[model samples]
Target: MSRERRLTAGAVAVLLVALLGVAVVPGVLADPSADGPVRPGRVSIAESPAIAPEEVDGATATLRLHTRIGHAGNPTDNVSVRFRAYDAESGLLTAERTVELEELTGDRSVPVNATIEVPREGGYVIETVVFRDGRVVDRDRTRVSGLAALGTEVHFTESEAVPPLSVSVASVDEEANRTTLTVAASLTNGGESASDRLRVEVVLRQAESNIVAARQSTTVSGIGPGRTADATVEVTVPSDYNYYVDAAVYRDGVLVDTARSVANLDPTETISANMTTREVEFEVSDFAGDDGSQEERATEAAARTETATATPGFGPAVAVAALAGAALLARRRTRQ
Candidate 1:
């Protein structure tokens, strides 16, 4: 063949290989096989897509959709999932998102998650499409109604340790030796729904040592959209010691957010939140003579002993048990 004809023929052969999905390696077609993330396979939808209301803002509703894409053959190229929301009445596209998919290895199925935000007034038709190498392989559609009735989740957060203690002061009494602090962590619910019974865990630590002075959990109620509430919990600790108040916000028993703030009561000492916290020390000297503190003091004197990181030489045990042991030892010595 002439040189010009040979060049044309070579170009045509390369085009044919690409069309057949064969990888040309080292100037040779290697066993008609594909390579890399761009290869296509039998991409199929294995189950019906699932849709649920995620959140609601002032005038819009957010919905989450989940799809499981399965492959029937060998490993394919990198895939993608496209979620589209269309107005049910006008058939106009409202929102769309494409998520890049991870390549399937030994796992035959990949779960894809997507969310769409639309006006909360009407119905919507959600469509899910799977694409491989820029080509649509599979598509599915589902319908959603009663957007107005979709309940939005109220997100609660604790931003600071004691942000302008909101409630009445009678719940906490400030004493000279030890004071009770009602940590009012500012929680904001930006979602469209109102929620109650949100839980917050507040821990008070001595600034000089990581020793946990008190830990308490309390519920914040009446949280509404764009409204701020307080996660208040009372923690009574030694008065002179500066304290770091740490708060953790949890939903359904799962930790969702955390925050810290300082309550520097001692002018001579400095304390900050977010530092590591440690266990308790048992001794009457630690909590002696404080009015109405006997119950909390006794709880600290429980059997479970912990090494006091801050208070060196503070023995681990109930203060009563320690005193009893000492008395027994003194009697034995006297008898001897």
Candidate 2:
């Protein structure tokens, strides 16, 4: 044979061997039966199961699994299902249970049920795991919320002597520029039952126009009977309006009590124009005495000199000096 023809034949033989290796070698190497019995077809979570709340301890979660087996595969027997409950906040396992299923065949849906106990009232999670033999085949998870029943009656009380639940605005302070109002309130629970969730809201509105100025809210948990809780909220309002501060209390999404107080703002202190920059400055101490209280005097002076001026011995120079001294003392007191 010629040298070129032999080389071409050898190249063709190498090309055929490469093609066969690509197609056949991987299948032979990947076949699990070459080592042992092949693993059965995969399983998956099929449907989202329903979760129902049980009265006191916890909730019940139902799960469904879909098993897909190949036509030539053996029946999957003695598969394990594990249900675990975890606290959503802390992610700690709170409850767990396991069940075993009978032999599963091609394209079948299996239903499993488990009850999870929640330690406290909050968010919780349920996880389902399907195991074939000792290996995990599929897993699924869902979340649930637990809430306690409102056992005790809740009401609003205006009188301090009355109990169960009461809310009152202790004070309303308005800044001199009428930009913000600070509301402070006290909440007392005199009822026999404690509230796990409590919400307090403070709203500011113009008394004359009934226009809402600002609203702020805060929350507290575990307010026991006969215990008192305090909340403060700062509300922004238009400058130069007589506003009313309303403090309200809520339990379990229901409004229980509300108290109202008035905030008298000076018309001159109202902000007339909108400020665009955040660095705008104002005198904080200017509103310190804006509570409308009369200025206190340091000392009291008698007008004995008025009557003494009628006496013949009283001299003009002495009277003038006494008047000037009194004026000086008054000026000094004003500064103090």
Candidate 3:
């Protein structure tokens, strides 16, 4: 071949290789199966102004999605975004909706916009999937909280007379997701009708942010009247928690008494000051013997009389008792 022909062929080969590098390499890099750059086309989701359920009167939740898809190659139309809602059990309760982009210019990015409605109030998992060529390229999920029925007051039958209770939190266990709390409440009534349900409300507050993060309530059954009930409540607390607890005792929709406690969430093994556990003991009351109350009065009276008698002349009696005890000790020692 002539030298000029050979130079033309060399130029053609170089141009072909340059086109392959620009076109074929991008396809291989964008392929999800190839361990290529994980470019599921970038994703961004935003929700419009919707009132949170706890703060609003009407129970409605609306959200808008503004998604941007980037690095998608040419002929990238028919790429759709789909949304689905699932229950706590992962059951598919609703059908999925897909929104298509207007059109991809010869550029490498596409933008799709969508709006979705939240129908019910409960725990829900929201998911967004990006589809290309009838297959899911990438997906993302987020949890929505405080979605339970709002304005629905949980009332206690025996809680009418009792005010809102206060709670003191003692400790929080992050690994186990449990908060240990001490609750104390006063019950009024002379032992006739007692409070059956005692539930303490624990509010978790954020320390640095100084905001109320979460609230949970737990109940203990069967508390008697004219007495104070002291107990511990174990509840689930979210991560990054600063919280305290409050308690209320109720009977037949009437609140009778309340209390509060404080809690901390440091998870360190602690050695208690008490080396051994001690059992609590109480004086048994004799209801059958009418002298039970009288005996108590007589015991108190004798104690006071002894205290008064020992004031001045009682010193001599103590000395005599000490001498007698010493004499007995000396006699025993001699015998030994």
Instruction: List TM-scores for all candidates, in order.
Output: 0.39, 0.35, 0.31
lDDT, candidate 2, 1-336, per-residue tens? 999999999999999998898797666546566677656655656665466654332232232322322222455776777777788989999888787777776766666665555554566777777788778877778887633322323334445554322223333434223465556566666678785676778776555455566778988667678776666666655555555667777655545566766665644433212212123233334323233422221111124555556578668998999999999999999999
Model 2 quality (TM-score): 0.35
TM-score of model 1 vs. true structure: 0.39
Residue 332 lDDT, candidate 1, scale 0-100: 100
Model 2 regions more than 4 Å off: 1-42, 57-73, 146-336
Off by over 4 Å in 1: 1-176, 274-336
lDDT of 3: 0.50
Query: In candidate 2, residue 143 scores what lDDT?
Result: 83
Cα lDDT computed for each candidate against the true fold: 0.69, 0.59, 0.50
Clashes of 3: 35
Q: What is the lDDT ranking, best to worst? A: 1, 2, 3
Deviation in Å, model 2, residue 99 alpha carbon: 1.4
Whole-model lDDT, model 1: 0.69
Candidates in order: C-alpha RMSD to true structure: 18.7, 15.3, 18.5
Which is the leading candidate under TM-score? 1
TM-score, ranked from best to worst: 1, 2, 3
Count the clashes in each prediction: 0, 0, 35
- Candidate 2 displacement at residue 201 in angstroms: 13
